[model samples]
Target: MNPSKTGLSFLWLSAVAFIADLATKYLVVTRFALYESIDILPFFNLTYVRNPGAAFSFLANHSGWQKIFFIVLAILISAMLVYFLFKNNAAQKLQNAAYALIIGGALANAADRAYHGFVVDFLDFYWQDWHYPVFNVADIAICVGAGLLALDAIKNGDKKKSEKKA
Candidate 1:
């Protein structure tokens, strides 16, 4: 269960995700105006959006508290991810990848909040007249990371059950 071999790949993935997320956010902010949408597919589009709150703009309606709250939360989560990455011994491939994704996403959004007082969102998908909320690279990373971790946990649990029977 030693995870030393996976550490390098984890770090590399994290770095790549973080950098790419940041770079894309930067491009969105610098290249496109806020709330602008460009069609990308039959039901997808690239949109420039800024969210001051957490996912789905929960606290976005708040005048100012959202900035401080999201910033603090991102910092706390990022710190926890770093600790888990370096200490967890049973680092299954999915778990390791999950941590990297979470770290990168957290860092990317944090940077956006610090620089623009909000997070930048661009990807947009819709069906006919119904549109989904705009999201960005960071959100994708976080969501995928959670899924990977969940899958890893289930896989490991099944393995352990089989081992006990054997």
Candidate 2:
């Protein structure tokens, strides 16, 4: 299959995710001082912060090595996701969208790591004093993509079970 017309058709979704992430990060970085926060609601805030490590600040306490590690991992994962997209059938809309989102989110974060050494995060949600991790558009895309994949798995599992029972 010609990837450009086949699975690669989903690249548009990837581009949307990538562009959105960068744009939001750019706005946050330009408008907010580091660690500056503005409460938007009882459970939400816009808090500018930087994450040098992976999800939930994993390995964030290290000196500086985590930046390189995350960047490299993002690149590797993005490449792998592209490969998966290329191999996937165009009719597999759910999987294609999931892969595209993961690719875009990964590449966006990698670009941030390359240019800024850390991912700019601004969206914050909390309940009282306990706050969830601050994250940005790219993180949202990655998480949504993962959730979609899990939902696809559940849907397919049911189909397989029905086919077996028949």
Candidate 3:
């Protein structure tokens, strides 16, 4: 099927997200020393660091095996997102965009995994002595995409309920 006729066209967004992720990571990796941090705002910082595991560095302290597992998982999820977009109508704009962002983020992280053996995280947020995990552009895209998807799901559920009652 022609990509322009389907949600596949949203891959442009994927390309943008992927490039942004890579560029930011490159800058952080090249410009900063490991664990180096620079404050951007009272509650935010640009701290360069490496993550060996998924979100919040889950299983980061594990042996070398988590790298392969995460890389494979990212590939599988990216494929699944593409499949979901390919199989559906372009009218599902919310889902399409969501899938595209996830695809871009997953692939970008996978690339980082294969190249750096870790995901580069730099956007840091904190309040007082407490700090949130450092993350990057891909993480932001993935999270925003996920939130959009959830919002869409909730909206459709409401629509379905209203239709059922009519």
Candidate 4:
């Protein structure tokens, strides 16, 4: 693949993820009130909530400084991801896709923070009384991206070990 095509793939994937994240957030905000929960299954529900801090609502109870901190951090990370996407080899599709997903998710959440001072979250999961933190599409993408990267790293490590023995 040419660099242009590789770059386009990254951009397209990022756009899709970003759009999905934004669209889902809009629907949740419009269709549900803050903290409103609707049962969707035996172990899941859609609950509207907002987080002004990082994952799991870390620093959410602070006096409003964490929002700015997260926004800046996201921007920095996004810039680094973009740089890596462009500098990476065209053949590295897995890495490119991983970076794209992370970039998209980071930007989506950053936009929410910039506009509303928090990220809108709705997906909720629980088993009995144990509940997971509410999250949004962006958070899901980020997690999936990180998982892919980890898998790729393990594959590469195994390949190197095998090659060394050959």
Candidate 2 Cα lDDT to native = 0.90
Q: Report lDDT per candidate.
A: 0.83, 0.90, 0.92, 0.89
Rank ordering of all candidates by lDDT, starting from the highest: 3, 2, 4, 1
Which one is best on TM-score?
3
Span of ten consecutive residues with least summed lDDT in model 1: 1-10
lDDT by residue for model 2 (88-120), tens? 888878888898998899899989989998889
Residue-level lDDT of model 3, residues 13-118, one tens digit each, is: 9999999999999999999999999988999999999999989999899997999999999899999889888887888888899999988998999899999999
Residue 49, model 2, lDDT: 96
Kindly report which residue stretches of model 4 are placed more than 4 angstroms away from their true locations once superposed: 5-8
Checking candidate 2 for backbone clashes, the offending pairs are: none
How high is each candidate's TM-score? 0.90, 0.94, 0.96, 0.93
**Model 4, span 1-166: residue lDDT tens:** 4668454358677888899999999999999989999999999999999998889999999999888899899889989888888787767777888888999999999999999999999999999999999999999989988988998799888999999999
Count backbone overlaps in model 4. Answer: 0
Residue 150 of model 2: what lDDT? Answer: 92
Model 4 C-alpha lDDT versus the unseen true structure = 0.89
106 Cα displacement, candidate 4 (Å)? 0.4
